[model samples]
Target: MIPLKDNIPSRRFPLVTLTLIIINTLVWLFERSLGPSMENLIFAFGVTPADLFQYGLVSQLFFMTTAMFMHGGWMHFLGNMLYLWIFGDNVEDRMGKFRFLIFYLITGYIATLAHVLSDPTSTSPLIGASGAIAGVLGGYFVLFPHAKVLTLIPIFIFIQIIHIPALYFLGFWFLLQIFNQTFQGAQSVAFLAHIGGFAAGALLVKFFQKYRY
Candidate 1:
């Protein structure tokens, strides 16, 4: 299911979200410019579990932030940026630009930490902004549970668009992450990080609602 858009109206322009998207895009472009040396770029910026385990906490902290902007490929960046565009405005509306920016970074850092804890011995470099954007989705769903989302459903050669409630879409996604973590044990994506971001967003959104209002 590809989420096209959500129904929530933002009170302010999402400058912070736009800025983050631009920054991520530039960083990705810089990585691509290096061509074959992208391996060093990825290692330098992306989170490595073994490095975190051996080198104490500095590498962990640095990568926790950098990893959010360093995506693996085109599809990875597209999916994450799409979700961020869809849900980030509502969150930025509620939290305002500055606080929302802080919220995003905090949840992202927490999410990366969750990934690191999940596989401390693995050498795979964790990358992408999905965890942070997953947090935005989590917070947005709480605020606008009944909002309709335009989604594209692709079934092999067949494809169609459908409107679905925010709750149904995000709830099913959360459940799928849980199921994956339980059965597959973090093979493909960072399911635990997604869950962590979701939980952090849900809790932090509630905490910041009064400030927003």
Candidate 2:
């Protein structure tokens, strides 16, 4: 099921979330402008466990933070932005602007660390905001478990729209990430990062959020 939107409306404008999306979009555009240099950029900005360990502390921190804003392709960027657009606003609303922004970066760092720990020797550059968005999902899951999400589910030739509770939707998503990471092993996608982000989000949201239940 693909979530289109959620029932919980933001009490205030999601400044941080919108800003992040704009930044991601602008960065993606700049990356495309690089053409041949894009690969080098991703490698330089992206997080690789080997590179993180090899680099100095400052460089490692740079990669960890910048990696969240980079994406591999249009679909990658759109998919991550879509989730952030939907779930992020409500989370931002609950956590307050400044706290939500910091929370996002921290969870993203945690997510990257999770990936690095899972495959310390892998040299592949891990790009995209999937892990960070997964963190948003985690926090949203905690703060808005009962919120309804309008989702699109494709069945063969037909498309069905379903209203799903955040609990079940996020729960299934987290489980799927874990399952894929366990079964798929090493692949292009960082399933471990997603799981890590989601887990971190769920746990961190409690401390970050102002409202309860």
Candidate 3:
């Protein structure tokens, strides 16, 4: 199932969400322009647990921030940006632009930390904005459980769009992450980062409920 959109509308302009989308898109384009040379970019910017643990300084700091912009592939970038565009506006509308931006970065950093903790020795560089976008999903799930998500369900070659309850869709997504992370044992993709960002979003929303405005 692919999410095409959602029914929830924001009362205010989600500048932060839009800005983040632009930034991510630009970064992806830049990496794509590099073609085979993108590996060099990933090695420099993408998070590597081994580098963090060994170098333990500026390299780690750069990766912690840069990792959020680096993505493994086209689908990876589109899927994450789609989720952010769908759910991020509502959260940003409630939290205000600045706070929402900060919240996103914090959850993203926490997600990266979770990835590092899981595989501190792996040389594979962790990349993608899903972890951060997962946080937006997490927050939206909490704040608007009843919201409707318009999704495209594919059956063989047939495709149909339907609206599903936010709780059901988001809940299923989260559970799938946990299930995959547990059974796959961290082989491909940082499923644990998704879980961590989701948890962070849920907890952070609780922590600053009053500030949600």
Candidate 4:
């Protein structure tokens, strides 16, 4: 299911969300410019679970944060940005700019750590914003459970558009991650990171919102 938009409107400008999107876009463009050297960039900046454990806290922090802004391909980049554009605004609106920014980074870090812990021996470099965007999805799930999301469901040859509640939509998404991780066993995507990020966001959103806006 692809989420096109949501029913809940943001009361405040989603400056942080927009800025994050811009930064990710620019970083992706830079990655494209790297051409043949893009592999080098991914190794340098992306989080490799085994290598991540061998690094110092500073270097580990560097990889965890930098990885979120990078993408593996056009599909990866566009999919993440679409979800962020659809769901991130309301989350940013609820948490305010600074808190939301902090929340995003923290959840992303936690997501990376979750992936590391899941398979510390694996050597693949994890990239993209799906994990962090998963956090935003989790926050949206908690903050706006009743909100409706206009989703695109492709049923083989036909496409169906339906309004799904945030609760069911995100719940299914989280479950799908688990299902993929359990059965698929880590193909290219880091399902554990998505799971961890979503869990982190759901657990942390209330605490982040407790502070004065």
Candidate 5:
């Protein structure tokens, strides 16, 4: 399901969310400009669990954060940023800009660790903001369960845009992550990371909630 928008409105400008989207776009542009050097860049910046064994502490830690800002392809980038655009604004609003930024980075790190725990020896490079955005969705689920998400769900020949409660939308999303992780056995997508990030955001949202405007 593609979320077109949410019913909830932000009281303040979503500076953080807009900033994130812009940063991601700029990073994507830089990655594209790399041309043949793209593979090298992704390897250097993207999180590889095996790198933990090879690189120094600082470098390994840096990879975890850098991986979130990188993307493997245009579709991968768009899907992640779309989720962030739909849900991140309200999350930023609730947590406030400074706190929300902290929450986002921490949850993303947790998400990366989750993938690492899944297979610590794997050399595959994990990249993209889906895991971090999954954290945002988890927080949204906790904070606005009843809010309606206008989703574009395709069925047969017709694509339908329907309003789904945030609880169900996010619940089903989390479930899909688990389901794929359990049965699919990790093809290309990082299911474990999504599961971990979602759990972190859902559990941590209450503590992070602050009215700073």
Candidate 6:
């Protein structure tokens, strides 16, 4: 299920969310321009669990943060940005710009750590904003459970648009992550990070919103 939009509208401009999207887009374009050198960039910035554990957290902090802004491919980049565009604004509206930014980064960092812990011996570089965007989805789930998400569901040969409540949509998404993590073993994607980020976001959003109230 791909979320197209949500029923909730932002009371204020989602400046941080748009800025993040622009930055990710520009970074992606720069990565494209690098040609064969893109692999080097991903290795340098992306979080590799083995490298992270060996080097220690203090030294690997930069990579942990940079990894969130990096993406493995066009689909990876676009998919993350799409979810952020759909759900981030409402979360941002609820938490305010600064809090939302901090929330995003914190949840992302936690997500990366979760991935690292899940497979400490793995050597592949972990990159993308899905974990962070998953946090935004988590926040949306708690803050706007009643909001309807316009989603595109492809049923083999047919495409259908459905209005799914935020609660059910996000709940299903989280469950899917758990199911993937349990059955799929190790793959290119970090399903644990998504679970960790969503759990963190759902847990911390209320605390962040307390400042607003």
Q: For residues 98-123, could you state the per-residue lDDT of candidate 2 as single tens digits? A: 98988898888888888888878889
lDDT head-to-head 1 vs 6, winner: 6
Q: How does each model score on lDDT?
A: 0.85, 0.89, 0.86, 0.91, 0.91, 0.91
Q: Where is model 3 more than 4 Å wrong at Cα?
A: 55-59, 208-213
List of clashing residue pairs for candidate 1: none
TM-score of each: 0.92, 0.95, 0.93, 0.95, 0.95, 0.96
CA RMSD of each candidate after superposition:
1.8, 1.5, 1.8, 1.7, 1.7, 1.3
Q: Model 5, range 1-213, lDDT digits (tens) per residue?
A: 999999999998999999999999999999999999999999989988878656644768788888889999999999999999999999998999998998998889889888888888889899989888988989999999999999999998999999999999999999999999999976589999999999999999988999733
What is the overall TM-score of model 5 with all chains considered together? Answer: 0.95
Ranking 2 against 5 by lDDT, winner? 5
47-121 in candidate 6: lDDT tens per residue?
A: 899988899988988888898888879999989999999999889998889999999999998898899998899
List where candidate 2 sits over 4 angstroms from the true fold. 55-59, 211-213
lDDT of 4 at 11: 82
Candidate with best TM-score: 6
How does candidate 1 fare on TM-score?
0.92
For candidate 4, lDDT tens digit of each residue in 121-180?
Answer: 888899989888999989989888999999999999999999999999999999999999
The weakest ten consecutive residues by lDDT in model 5 span 50-59
Q: After superposition, how far is residue 184 of candidate 3 from its true place, in Å?
A: 2.4
Clashes of 1: 0
